[model samples]
Target: MELVTHSPGDGVYPPTGDYAHAIEVRGAERLVFLAGTMGLDPSGVPGATLDDQLVLIWSNIRVILASAGMTVDNIVRLTSYLRDASYAGANAKARVEALGGRVVPTTAIVAQTLDSEWLIEIEVTAAS
Candidate 1:
């Protein structure tokens, strides 16, 4: 699979170590779009902080991808809904580390989420 990224002149550069872009995967036979995942752990406990939430979300994404016979590398896009956009840089860095620095899905971070108590929500699109 091929990953695609770009930096448009109108957009701010992603914080250091991250890309302000999206990834595109070509020649895939099937695609999957995951529902937005919240910060709940397997037992339904909420993560204590934004970073914790990010880790849990990425882990959940990995599980979902595996179930579909794909890996994190197959993910083409990630849209994160965050309670506060100020946390984007640190959260993005955490995500890159979680994904092993190889899968750079096109990402968008937005302020505000469906619930006030949720620090972050992540939705992904993948192919296989």
Candidate 2:
């Protein structure tokens, strides 16, 4: 499980959150692209708060990765859909915690709404 991250010293500024400028995986034997995941628990109940939902969302990602015999370290990139752009701070904090500060390339877009009443949705791409 080795990934190469690039943070150029040139004009491009370094990323300030739990992400890298870019990542490259060499000799990856397998790759997985997960569906856009919502923050619903096993019981199908959404979290009561934004932070709780964010935590549960990552937990959901973990489960999906585990099913493929992979872990967070195998994740190379993620795209997030946020219902509200104002949650960026809390979202970034949650992301840092979820990845244990690992630098994964990420892109966040503010969507008008998700499939359901979800406050956030995330999709991940992993390699192994």
Candidate 3:
């Protein structure tokens, strides 16, 4: 599989974070669409802080992707739901770290989560 990120420099503003405006996948045989995931533990406990939650969320995503025979490098798109707009910076930081600075199409929105304890939720699409 091959992945191409598009970030037009003239017609659009540059991406503000470590993400692209769009991604194109070619010759992909498998596609995995993950559910909106929160930073809950095995016993369904949320992390106490944003940093802690970010770590758990990435770890959970890793396990889920592995189960589907994919890795973070296979991620092509991601949508993040943040309880508050202020969480955007931290969320972007965690995403860059998790993906090792690999830019992908990403969107973050300020919205309420199903659970009060969930500060952020992320759903990703991986193709391989």
Candidate 4:
């Protein structure tokens, strides 16, 4: 599939951080929509810190992608649910690292999670 990122260089304000204003996916034969995944380890334990949770969440996402013969490059969109807005920077940094700087449409929201221990939950849409 061909991924086209639309970022207006003039007139409109540019997107902040590592994300495109919009993404156009072309010739995609498959679309994978993952449910909201928490930062749980193999034993289903939540991480104590934001960084730790971010690491675990990305690791889980990678495993899920691999199961479908896809990689982080196939990620077209992502939504992050954070316990607090302060975690935004760390979250963005993790996303950049996980996708190797491949920008996609992303949104972050601060919300209360089902489990208080869960500092973050992420859901993604991938196409290939």
Q: In TM-score terms, which candidate is top? A: 3
Give all candidates' CA lDDT scores. Answer: 0.74, 0.87, 0.93, 0.94
The root-mean-square deviation over C-alpha atoms between each candidate and the true structure, in angstroms, is: 3.1, 1.4, 0.8, 0.9
Angstrom error of the Cα, residue 94, model 2: value is 1.1
TM-score of 3: 0.97
Global lDDT for candidate 2?
A: 0.87
Candidate no. 4 TM-score: 0.96
Give the runs in model 3 whose Cα sits over 4 Å from its true position.
none
Clashes in model 2: which pairs? none
The window of 10 residues in a row where model 2 has the poorest summed lDDT is 112-121
Candidate 2 global TM-score: 0.92
lDDT of 4 at 23: 97
Off by over 4 Å in 4: none
Candidate 2 vs. truth: CA RMSD? 1.4
Per-residue lDDT tens digits of candidate 4, residues 5-113?
9999999999986999899999999999989988999999998899999999999999999999998999999999999999999999999999999899999999999
Question: Which residue segments of model 1 deviate by more than 4 Å?
Answer: 4-17, 20-22, 103-105
Off by over 4 Å in 2: none
- What TM-score does candidate 1 reach? 0.79
Model 4, poorest ten-residue lDDT window? 13-22
Candidate 2 lDDT at 18 equals 74
